[model samples]
Target: MLPASTFVLGGAASGKSEWAEKFIESYDLPMIYLATGQIFDDEVAAKVAKHKNRRDGRWETIEEPLDLAPALASLSEKQAVLIDCATMWLTNHMMQDSDLSTEQDALIEALTACRAPWVIVSNEVGQGIVPENALARQFREAQGRLNIALAQQAGLVVQVVAGLPQSLKGRLP
Candidate 1:
């Protein structure tokens, strides 16, 4: 059976989101795609378009770059939500100068409280060399912390690399 939640972690373009989508689809539940990416340039817009094209009528996409509480709260146990992903969500909050600790705590609480099963995708940003800029370094640190918390809360944790998934904490359902 699918667990309450699964944390999918990987580097950029590591096929994490695609793996998560398939994981959620296996359960045959109504799918809710909670998108956190915000388009500020042509590149991002094109990327978002690609993701949209990947989904069919089975998905109900919710575009909320910040504040996922409302959409998460509206889900039921009969549904499954894919929050693809945490990196962009963290970026949005960081750009707004939000309190990282407070926001992270709230997000964890909300995810735990959510009634539906979920697959949350996040980037493994700490694998690369240290960034030179302070902002980049700060983002890497924050993402690492968030990923840790998510892994701890999740019943299953998988790390994707080169389009392959390796289970970390629990067996893949």
Candidate 2:
């Protein structure tokens, strides 16, 4: 069967990444951990380090805080890539005032063109209270729109709540 692309959605600290990791481990292939968070402070750095410590060294780790399209396009068909989180990737792009439409288009194209399976983890940001600031509101709106688009293209979409996963689109492995 052809490899599938999955989108895992959840709130912060909702265990989406953990769930995605378990799913990737089941494939028994050369795994790739695509981390999109850039450590801007000690707290963020520690969190990133924790994630790295949890993964098996056998998996190749790619840290692309922004411009993930090129990195995704370079992978081989024998690999299974797990993007730890898309929220941070979006944050990285937005912080730099990057071209949102162009970046997202590139990302979607790269994901569709990937030869191997991929598990993408992202935050479900639309369920919370509305942001007080304009920038924060814009970010939430953009994230929500991006999630909707990704879900539509994904072969499988899973949602996590309080560490519990519920398959929303396709069958679970």
Candidate that scores best on TM-score: 1
Clashes of each: 0, 0
lDDT (C-alpha) at residue 61 in model 2: 92
Compute the lDDT of residue 108 as modeled in candidate 2.
Answer: 91
Best by lDDT: 1
Off by over 4 Å in 1: none
- lDDT for 79 (candidate 2): 89
Please list the C-alpha lDDT of all candidates, in the order they appear: 0.94, 0.88
What digit string (tens of lDDT, one per residue) describes model 2 on residues 65-117? 88788788888878899987789989998999998888888889889998878
> What is residue 138's positional error in candidate 1, in angstroms?
0.7
User: For model 1, how does the per-residue alpha-carbon lDDT over 26-145 read when each residue is reduced to its tens digit?
Assistant: 979999999999999999999999989989999999999989988999999999999988999999999999999899999999998999999999999997999999999999999999
Tell me model 2's lDDT, rounded to 2 decimals: 0.88
